[model samples]
Target: MSAKQTGTKNRSPMQYSDWPIEQLPGLSQEEQSQLQNCGIKTTVGLVKQGKTLQDKVALAKKLQVNLQYVNKWVALADLARIPSVGTQYCGLLLHSGVASVAQLAQTPTHRLHKQILRLQVATMQRRDLCPAIEQVQQWSQQARIVLSDEC
Candidate 1:
């Protein structure tokens, strides 16, 4: 049944971020299982459980991964909270220097677009594959919405 039919509002990640952890890029199957073992099977869980530096350090100790790995994973999970910039493009946004949804929200769209374009050209060797300006604008707008919802 649809959310409307169920009397629900179909909230976005801005309100309740909860996508499968596997959907976030770069996590190995083992890592997914490890997180799942800790009852963190979704992005929301990762974000909530790893919110602080101390939490991240504890997670690193439990998962037996580098502190940097846990930090990067938490960042990816945080970015995935933006509905328009979900798992698919969260990594791109990160590599393009967007460390958080708040950053994406405040960044000038054209500048962010240029950064993404430069990274795409340098790594993918194809500017054509870069996201369009319109899409980038949507991400920024959605990020702003997400941030506003937090307040």
Candidate 2:
């Protein structure tokens, strides 16, 4: 076990914020387990190489899975690293083609907000999927923080 995994019995869940893969956004519980079963047990495992399209394709080939799934998982890992954008919002962003917090941080909030509104309208069955402007702003701000911290 890693030093981070050590003493898990005594650690409160909130006591650690370093488990990026465990906290990956946009994944159902089952999908998370599946990724681990397929040997992607860490955020670095999925995204260690700058998370390029080529990297995702390589992972898909290595795991013998669909490219789309690998892409989404990489995106989820990246987004989950941000403090404010949790799993639920991660889904919303995924639908908007946001594959990383780096992308989110660079996006203009108004553009993302409008894009989400359009997505909601296109997928009209889920009328309750509204994301507030303030929340998106916070996500973008937090994404910036995460990017800086990684550097």
Candidate 3:
């Protein structure tokens, strides 16, 4: 399936109550209950915070989840949003010294190629990274244009 189709198809129910919070890592029962109460049950819910640190922190607090956990959810969400990028590849990118979406977007093709090679060595499987790198570059260019327009 195309990435857009996969995204729509993979979407969880809109209601937070429908999420299986028990399956989330490192969440206590109390935290789960609090998250449900605050209308944030799915990982995606936690990741949709507006573009502000305070917003993310408040959301995390309301859900009784750690701020770091919320940050991680956001990072994972961003990686998932990237076409052809998965959690494993995201981890590999981090291990290869690319820690954030901005960093990944700004990375040169040569560096990205080297990182992917390193990841292949660790995983014993080759990953096609060109699509993801191209996507990042496109996103970065668009973001720059938007930011410049705002300024």
Candidate 4:
């Protein structure tokens, strides 16, 4: 089904831009710099093959850091790469207890839409914040593809 068929409108969703890797959530300043030194500059730059986290394991080994930490950053960056999720929306998802793309993949689209709606209301920036169910479907589908161990 299409968004138009489902009565989903654009609602002026927030626009996202590429941010420095240091801006990725859940990472300390040291870790951000570490990734930067290792050549990861932007969230989009971290992953190459679609939604996969690219070479997180290899990067961890090269950086001599905990694999979990690298994996965490990779996941966050992956979510940021979603068409509309961006860094700001990723922050909202993290604060709302949705941490990983894998978790986002599991979340019901209606629930995500509801939570995001509540967030927009609570924040009082309701301008064009409403999202259609179809957008959430795209997000979940993309996450699922990324999490299908296809990386």
Top lDDT hit: 1
The local lDDT score (0 to 100) that residue 129 gets in candidate 4 is: 68
* Per-candidate clash tally: 0, 0, 0, 0
Worst 10 residues of 1 by lDDT: 1-10
- Best candidate (score: TM-score): 1
For model 2, how does the per-residue alpha-carbon lDDT over 83-114 read when each residue is reduced to its tens digit? 46654466678888787778999999999998
Candidate 4 accuracy as TM-score:
0.54
Candidate 4 clashing pairs, residues 3+ apart or interchain? none
In candidate 1, which residue pairs clash?
Answer: none
Which regions in candidate 2 have their CA more than 4 angstroms from the true location?
1-34, 42-45, 49-55, 125-128
Candidate 3 has an lDDT of 0.51
**Candidate 1 per-residue C-alpha lDDT over 28-132 given as tens digits, one digit per residue, 9 for 90 to 100:** 999999999999988878888998899999999999999999988888988887766777788999999998878999999999999999999999999998999
Question: Which ten residues in a row are the worst by lDDT in model 2?
Answer: 1-10
TM per candidate comes to 0.88, 0.70, 0.50, 0.54
* Clashing pairs for predicted structure model 3, backbone only: none
lDDT of each: 0.82, 0.67, 0.51, 0.65
Q: In candidate 4, which residue ranges exceed 4 Å CA deviation?
A: 1-17, 49-54, 94-107, 113-151
